[model samples]
Target chain A: MTAAFLRVAILPLVAGFASLALAADIPTAERRSGSEFMGPETRAMQDDDTTNPGMLWVLDGEAAWRRREGAADKSCADCHGYAQTSMNGVAARYPAFDAAKGRPVDLEERINMCRSEQQKATPLPFESQALLALTAYVGRQSRGQAIAVADDARTYPFIAAGREIFERRQGQLDLSCASCHDDNWGKKLAGAPVPQAHPTGYPTYRLEWQTLGSLQRRLRNCMIGMRAEPYAYGTAENVDLELYLMWRARGLAIETPAVRP
Target chain B: MVVLACSAAAAAPGEPALRSFAIVGDAIPDSLTGAPGDAARGRAIVFNRQVGLCLLCHSGPFPDEKFQGNLAPDLSGAGARSSIGQLRLRLVDASRLNPATIMPSYYRTEGLTRVAPAFVGKPILTAAQIEDVVAFLATLQE
Candidate 1:
């Protein structure tokens, strides 16, 4: 039996080596060549800009954070003081598994949770400009910190579910998330080079939209391309997808409201 | 109907040929449009790698692949959800459908200033390619 198992493993190893050899032989378009086609000036423009448009939302969020609202007469300042010092790196560990809720919660969800549980306020509507600004402000706290999602047993199922959703084929296009993002990244489609679907920076500013938007909104846009029915704004599918994205970008820095072409 | 007749009478047979065409301002059914597209041709546009490469921003039926764009929608069976006219608008120039769209016009005839000189007269996709793509989309019922 052991000998048979060894044989099976050996066969796969040989096949894997053959596949690697074939891959190496294939000619790949050089990175510089692709960049040149896009134009050196355009590329330089992208690198020159450091201030993310999302910063605009963050500024607004700062104001909202300080202003006293709700029936309880409390403000975000009441609990968290001087965000730069008190909330630094807080965004990096969000979308965390909340034991009380028995589910994963993103920064937006946490903000709303705090409003109701501690501030005695009504939760902000998802996708509302106010909520986006709040999220941007909170996310700014973890600008340089590496994302660190929990990988404990309790959270494993959620992560796995998220992964499944990412891989599942959907819509009229019969496409799975893995098809383009995982498979064809770095290649040009239409006129744009496909970037890895990393969530390091979110609530990003898009030149196409000329506005700041949340990661969920971005995902919704992708679904429309797939021609699949999108989940409601706060549905479990979206949350699960967020969980997967956060985990995928576990070590990348959070650049919320980043600029993209 | 009168406006259509007048426009058709006024249009020189070849003038419509050079003008950038896109289906706009009407909710025409797919059945009334031209015949369905050819999947083989549509696949070329979808997976050209250097051109159409729809896979860039979307995930689709093609599973034995890697790397796609993350910003756009997927296109597994787009035909079932949208009409041919809507598809035409998206293909001719998605900016018309959603001014925010990053997708470029495959049949642009005007506004060449925004594009490179080499691509000014050249469309991203030929009319035949668009027809084939639409035909293929019509087949994706499920």
Candidate 2:
């Protein structure tokens, strides 16, 4: 009996080892966005700029971009000059590998980096209205463009780490992100449908939250729901996870300021 | 939701004391409360969102509730599937059955990481509540 049990256990160990050579679980052809699962009202809200509440942040961000700030007295427009032409499709390719930081830096962190280094300004706090507004505005420029994370060796390790985090069970519930998003997407958990968790629409507005929130905020919320210790904002884990999601979401159109219920 | 103590003065109000119970194979043959639970109360608890949260991951034979979950096994015919003792053990801690289960241990409070400050040292459900849930589940023989 012990020999049979050992054989059964060792077979799974071998299979687990084999699976480390990770392939995308959801095929490129089959990947679906979170928007597909939403109600018609919410989808209509995302489709129109005027109806979407997240557009408010986008508008505020547009104003902040043109306004001069910091000791250097430079606005974002001073360096980038016209978001429609220069900033278009930029948000699709983040969190990118940062050579200076020796790690991945998300769009928010990149914005902060530019602020501190170029504008000589204080960094914005995570989830602050100003930061959300700025991220929404920038991300809005990438709307309709496919999410395209850099796929070179520089980002490979971080992406793997993110995948590990997604698969590893944690918290009192012993649930991983994959337990719901991968294993059981399209199923209902209570009344609500479980989304595919594509990082397509962000800084997306959630009706439950009644405000625009970043992808990191959403990630933290899931971790808390799992009863796990959410990493502090701006931590490497969050950025790495963002990178992995962006990579997983490659080919999906950006939908910044997308409305969700 | 009310917890009764033999010596009321020694226990904090509304605080549930965990009773020692033996696990016999895959079941807990003994009741945690030393008395049969009220099935009506158990059914009420199952339907209550704040208390049981069972509907979050289970669907059952209630025609009224619009949104039952599809995450776990349906509560319909659960009594026919599991023995009462088996149901009790599962409510206590399912990780012993399946380590990767998303179901929370409704009656366990230890070894959990990063529990919210307000819920520290408290099981998701009381001992009597577990029995109540078990009794309720045992009635779904169809």
Candidate 3:
């Protein structure tokens, strides 16, 4: 081939191959999580229940578990007996698809399902202390378990929508979740390290928030940060995104009540 | 919480509709507001959490701040690569350039929902602040 041919055709081909190699270098689900990017002190905070402020909510959840409410006058403990056994590994698999609801439901939604259906009680408002407490308590049960959201025939559609949201950019800023979590993770922008943003921990303790918050709250924070209008809590878009995140971080160990700075 | 940077009086009686400009290569003068641009004030707006909140997703030369994120590009030498026009276009509205960008439009008011009531019908920054940021960014050469 002529030298001109190489300059025009082969050079662009070489650049394309380099881009593919760079794409391959990004971490896979097995090796990536926000926890790895955090400092030792932050990790320790998530590890030790005593040091973790999120633990306070877990304790409240434990109390709420046994306290009877609603017309039926029953408690979570009444039906399940003990969270450690009955609720174990359950949080790791949510925002699971509910065949009846025809959509995915996160841990909070599922808890409300049990409350409204079984307890004959009113569902708690989103971001309320009682809901955060119960979510923290139930999420704690699945600690150390690997996340297991899936993309089966029944769930593939919502998972697909979630993936679209992850990749599709929006807002006045016109950026997507992938721009950070998928593209720029581990890079330092200001001074903080970006993580793969695995949703392993929900109802996490964010130092920025100065209190315990749900994944929905964090998602809203991100939307605001992006300069996009946030979806109302409990919207299909939000739940679908959560489902996609859970599926994305499928193998990562659950760290419910995680600490984030 | 939205920060009313200058004043409601600074706003023109009839704000012009947000014009979709091409990814910028030319500087836009203080068009919407006639106030003189000030760079020092721009830096304040960028760093303040109640205002620009730029530091949340961006990092710059400032060292006193904590918990600055890495989701977006650092601004240490932004002036070296981008012109004032480019920066202004980005700050005004980036979605038109790349519809999927996560950056907020500092100067857009239309097509947004769930905005704080106080910020309604008002851009996040005035034309003067946009020029001020453009001025400050222009000084950040390597």
Candidate 4:
């Protein structure tokens, strides 16, 4: 073959192989939930609703759903009506596109949006007991359901952005999320097993914190571990990262109100 | 704790100032504290969770320790594998050798992004402490 023919055909093929190597996501069959890494005690806590502390928040959320608040004098029950029916599989498709805001929003933001637009209530502060309760309640509805985040033209760029953040090394340690969750997963980091970081068990109850926390709280904790400045809650970057994690965790069964060490 | 005394000359209020040094090949040939670090004190730093945090991502020759990390290479034969200068360089900043290393630069204070307020302008370990870690790692010949 002529030099031009070799350059045209072989170089592109080589480049394609290189790109594939760089972006090698874990095979679908190999994806494991973070729960699998927990100790038997923690796993048992998650498996049983009676023992799970996260259930307390879920119960509180049930009450909040029915209680009337704000000037509109309407409860979440009035509009959404029976979270068990309306919110089923809802948490599975979060960090979804918002046409009005021209951006992606997570489950927490969606609840706030509904409160302001539908119930005419004040947006709940992030990480507050009330918000955590509501999130856990709604997330519990999607238990055992597979994560199926939106992956269309509108969300493609944001997912890509999240992927960039996941891979980019930051902080004094200069380690990326991929360095631990992707590369060193299933291995022990000082007695604790490093999990594959699927977002399947968010709005989870952590034994260390002794309370329920959102995925944003967990992400911020990880950023701190890397000695990096964590992004504030509800930031575009945070939502984008959630979008990417949920997309990566597609088909994994949701384990909301999960208890973890 | 013994290493803290060595930093008196370089201490700036609450902060420990980074010591200047030259890189020779892939190593820093000089002792960071001018005096050779105490190996005993170095061992204490390595095993001290609040100080070194080494066991967080490394498995060493300490049989007494129940929990050891599996992230980085085993530290059992570290001295047999590297020179004292090399160990010093690795502790100071392993990222200099491999940019993607999860090992924190224990003595570097510049070019870092978004450092927490409590850790601003501070390296993970002081210069004397880095020397102490290097000294201890150099003794792990087995």
Candidate 5:
């Protein structure tokens, strides 16, 4: 081949390599600063520090803890007994496998289970005020306790299922939950920082929603953003996703009904 | 008398109509026009189950749309509050208006995923649709 033609062909090839080198450097350019690793602004909003606005939910939950609600003339107080003593650290080890139900159960599910089995009351709806209050109250008992999701054989399958869902690619974006939350966490998308999808503080009052929602609800929202067909409410998939999130946040303190910006 | 004269001057011919198109930062001047919107069409852009689905973040004037979220601003008087240019900026590229707004730009014709091939170069709403919605908003002025 003529030198001129050879240079012409090689020029485009060199340009292609240059573009590849530029693309490779993009990630380094996007490397997050130290402050970026300290979680997003939403973390501050979810902090259960003494100044949290959602602290009111704890008070409401305490009230509901003592008030009678079921048809059989039973209140949570009748069975669980003074929450401060009986329920301490109970929230830290939940969504565990229940041999009776043959599935994992979170604090909400467990509360409703007790309501139906012992209290004879109708189970409160998910994200309902009553449910929030009760879960907040119960979770508050373990406010300082570190999360301790058991990885026993019985719970392992659900945890695996949850992790699978977290890593599975889905929707129009063809992105997995891990892509943005786990891998790209602390990185800025557009201008807002992405947060690690930890379930340390849940039943959180989100500024985006202007209301309280459970971890399942947040998962569904992420699914919608990914343009994936979200699992229906109360589905095993959602519960499993919640299980995985709780496990990921195993050592983080439980801050239920947390406020988030 | 001064207030009445000022109000009269504000209502003078060409002035009121010009006011309709006026821009004030990012907000509209009037908020009570009474122009009726085609809820059906608006619903397509605002709450279409498979399309615009704006309710995913913003609460709109329509009720009965469950899951009416609140991540973005309320769009009850968006027409009167924003000039066509401002609205165009918001619809074409909201990042230009507010870098942190989670509201997706409906008129962004590129870099969007999961869109049908026919819609690749077209905005979610047509120019006429934007005008119709703006007309409805102009009616909201008091």
Candidate 6:
């Protein structure tokens, strides 16, 4: 059994070890904005900001931006001031390394950190409506701005872990994420086109889900789809995965509050 | 419509349950009761993504079927390469051959998690369905 497990675990690495870092690495043309894979009707829905269901959350986010909360009596606007100006492009460069904490944090985790530290407020629960609204609102600020997350030596380990997770086979399905997103993207599944899964329009609305969702929520859904155990919210594994997604999607424009089927 | 989950059509308690087949070099225990291979039924199951859902990872020569995936080997010539016993073993449980294979066990149910209640202990495909799939795959010599 151990021998079988070792063969399953190590064989793929041994097989792909030589050129694994070369031709098939990131910055390939496989990158596609999520919008490219959707049906035209859905694409049309996303194109019109007023018609997109995601915009409703963006409106809620606009309200949350000004509404005061927390023990510190601070709203997001109190510190950042006008998402159009202050928060612009911030979403594009997130999953940044937190120097003081000595870890990686995606935008959602960063938002939670601010709530705890700066606002003296308890962190909003994961997948909460309020959190989704605020994230969507903040994410919308970077529309059309290219993703530019970091991937230097300091972040190399996290990036590597993220890549490893992408390639690792997990769950009862024994499927790796790359099996779908990398190998068979653009193909149809059940009738829906499987996009390259570029993380360009996260905190976006999904047709399967009538409400807006964070990237973590979507990742959780994928884990469940594959029957794999998912990382807890705010865990290093989740953040590293997010960082890898951001790096994989580097230079793609942000499309927060975007709608998808 | 492509029903992603194979949890539908539950067998009542005491039906032919999912039998465990130990890997014996590309051969699985075949013949359940009086069931035998049926190509027509297998072809329908293969094309119907909801039941066999083999098209999710495999592409083959089925007209009018779109979105044939490319994650695994194409099944267009699968019959030519593999014998019926080999095909049966793979369909029963590919994991027994390669533990990390992305292929789901269509007829095994021991180590799985999050399976819908309707599917617990019930294999994704029945013994007859497995035979049907094997028969259909065997016809794909070209």
Count of clashes, each model: 33, 0, 11, 0, 10, 0
Compare candidates 3 and 5 on lDDT and give the better one: 3
**Model 6 misplaced stretches (Cα beyond 4 Å):** A1-22, B1-51, B59-82, B95-101, B105-129, B135-142
Q: Residue B65 lDDT in model 6?
A: 87
All candidates: CA RMSD in angstroms? 16.0, 5.8, 8.3, 6.6, 16.7, 7.1
- What are the models' TM-scores? 0.58, 0.87, 0.76, 0.89, 0.56, 0.78
Better of 1 and 4 by DockQ: 4
lDDT of 5 by residue, B94-121 (tens): 6445543345555444444443334434
Best by TM-score: 4
- Residues A1-261 of candidate 5: C-alpha lDDT, one tens digit per residue: 322223234433532211222221114334332223444665565563565656777788888888887788788898879999999988888877889878898888899988998889999998898898888778878875788877666777787678668766655434467656655565444234566676766777777787767777888888877666778777889888888777766667666656665
lDDT of 1 at A15: 29
Evaluate model 1: give its TM-score.
0.58
Which parts of model 1 have CA positions greater than 4 angstroms off? A1-51, B1-142
**Which prediction has more favorable TM-score, 3 or 4?**
4
Q: Evaluate residue B97 in candidate 2 and report its C-alpha lDDT on the 0 to 100 scale.
A: 71
Sort by TM-score, best first.
Answer: 4, 2, 6, 3, 1, 5
> How good is model 5 by TM-score?
0.56
Question: Quick one: how many clashes does candidate 1 have?
Answer: 33
lDDT of 6 by residue, A1-261 (tens): 332344345535633323224335434555788898777998899989879899888889899889888899898888988889998999998888899889888878888888988788899888888888888898999999999887676776777678778777656565667767765676666556677777898897998898888888888888877767777788888888888888888778888878887
Task: In angstroms, give how far residue A210 of model 4 lies from its true place.
Answer: 0.7
- Please list the residue runs of candidate 2 whose C-alpha ends up more than 4 Å from where it truly belongs after superposition: A1-24, B1-18, B110-113
Grade the docking of candidate 2: acceptable
lDDT of each: 0.64, 0.83, 0.76, 0.83, 0.62, 0.76
lDDT of 4 by residue, B29-133 (tens): 889879788788889999887789899899998989978898989999998899998898899877787765678888876767677766777788877888888
Per-model interface RMSD values are 16.3, 5.0, 8.4, 8.0, 12.6, 5.3
- DockQ, 0 to 1 scale, candidate 6: 0.22
Per residue, candidate 3 scores C-alpha lDDT tens digits across A132-204 of 9999999999999989875577777777677667665556444567777766677765567767778888899
Which order, best to worst by DockQ?
2, 4, 3, 6, 1, 5
